[model samples]
Target: MTNALTITDVRKTYKNGTEALKGVSFGVRGGEMLALLGANGAGKTTLIGILCGLVTKTGGSAEVFGVDIDAHPEQTRSMIGVVPQEFNFNIFERVGDIVIDAAGYYGIPRSVAAPRTETILKRLGLWDKRDAVGRTLSGGMKRRLLIARALVHEPKLLLLDEPSAGVDVELRRGMWEFVVDLNAHGTTIILTTHYLEEAERLCKRVVILKRGVVVQEGEIAELVRASGAKNLEDFYLRV
Candidate 1:
């Protein structure tokens, strides 16, 4: 099967002498959930930024659905959706408008974007909050709104960063179920999260990064076995 995303020897170095990524490489197949595990500043966000065309790599190449990001940024980015760790929407804007505006960024027509936004918001339990201003929503609601906005474009690949952060357990579980449903419907997912058990349960494959270097990558079970660890948390620590 063709990969939804491919990174080959990707490298990034900052002006301050910080190497955010060092020869990192990976492939994410369609309909698969790949968990990128790492401690704070392990380069997870940097890698995601590069993939989303928000950050330029110092070296190497990354492609989304066969389109090279550096060579065809607009084309590559159009194929992907990103739910960032930080809220990027105007806080005073209505939730519905925020989603619709995001869809427009991808050149989606209002007619096409509206229905999709409605469906996603309703599915994520945010339909009633559609008219509410972004600042009026709680943190969890904002997070769900972000995810819904990302889906408005019907991207083939979804990138989530710490999606469960600040969410209640029940809401987090609901988010997981929603993600599973999305993947079942053929959306490829790449997520970075501090929650190991969530990753263990939801992702078939895992990548462990330490100080900007990929230390391990493979099936979750294989990684657990190889590390002789009871779970992803233990495996991560061991690595």
Candidate 2:
């Protein structure tokens, strides 16, 4: 099967002499959930930005389901959804309106966006709070709102960046279930997270990055056994 995402010899360098990514590369299979593990300033966000067209790479290439990100940015972006670490919605806007408005960016009509918004909000457990403003919701609810907004257009590949950050354990587990269901339904997912347990639970494959370079990439179980580590945390430390 063709990969859902492909990055080859990708590099990014800021004008201030910071190299965010240095010849990084990876591939994610369709319908697969892959964990991108890294510390702060490990270039994970830069990589995601390149794929989303939010940041440009100085060298190399990226493709989404076979479409080149640089040559066909609009087309590739249409195939991906992103839930960033921060909440970017208008705090004063109604929950339902935020999602519907986001769908409009993809040229999805209100008539189409309305019901799709309803379905997504319901699935993410945000339907009851649909009339509330973003500021009124709890932290976890706000996170769910981000996921709802990202899924409004139902893209083929989903990029989740530190989604469980600041969320309580129970709420995070609930969010994981929803995300697992999404992957089960064939929505390819690439998750960047600091939670090692979350990564082991949800991802079949793992990629560990250190200082903009890939240090390890393999099936989670195999990597753990190969390193003779009890879990991902130990394996990560060993590497």
**TM-score to native of every candidate shown:** 0.98, 0.98
**Regions of model 2 farther than 4 Å from truth:** none
In the range 29-93, model 1's lDDT, one tens digit per residue, is 87899999899999999999999878889999988888899889889888899999998889999
TM-score of the candidate numbered 1?
A: 0.98
Lowest summed lDDT over 10 consecutive residues: which window, candidate 2?
Answer: 48-57
Per-candidate Cα lDDT values, in order, are: 0.92, 0.95
Candidate 2 achieves a global lDDT of 0.95
Residue 148 deviation, candidate 2, in Å?
A: 0.3
lDDT of 1: 0.92
Off by over 4 Å in 1: none
* Residue 140 in candidate 1, Cα distance off native in Å: 0.4
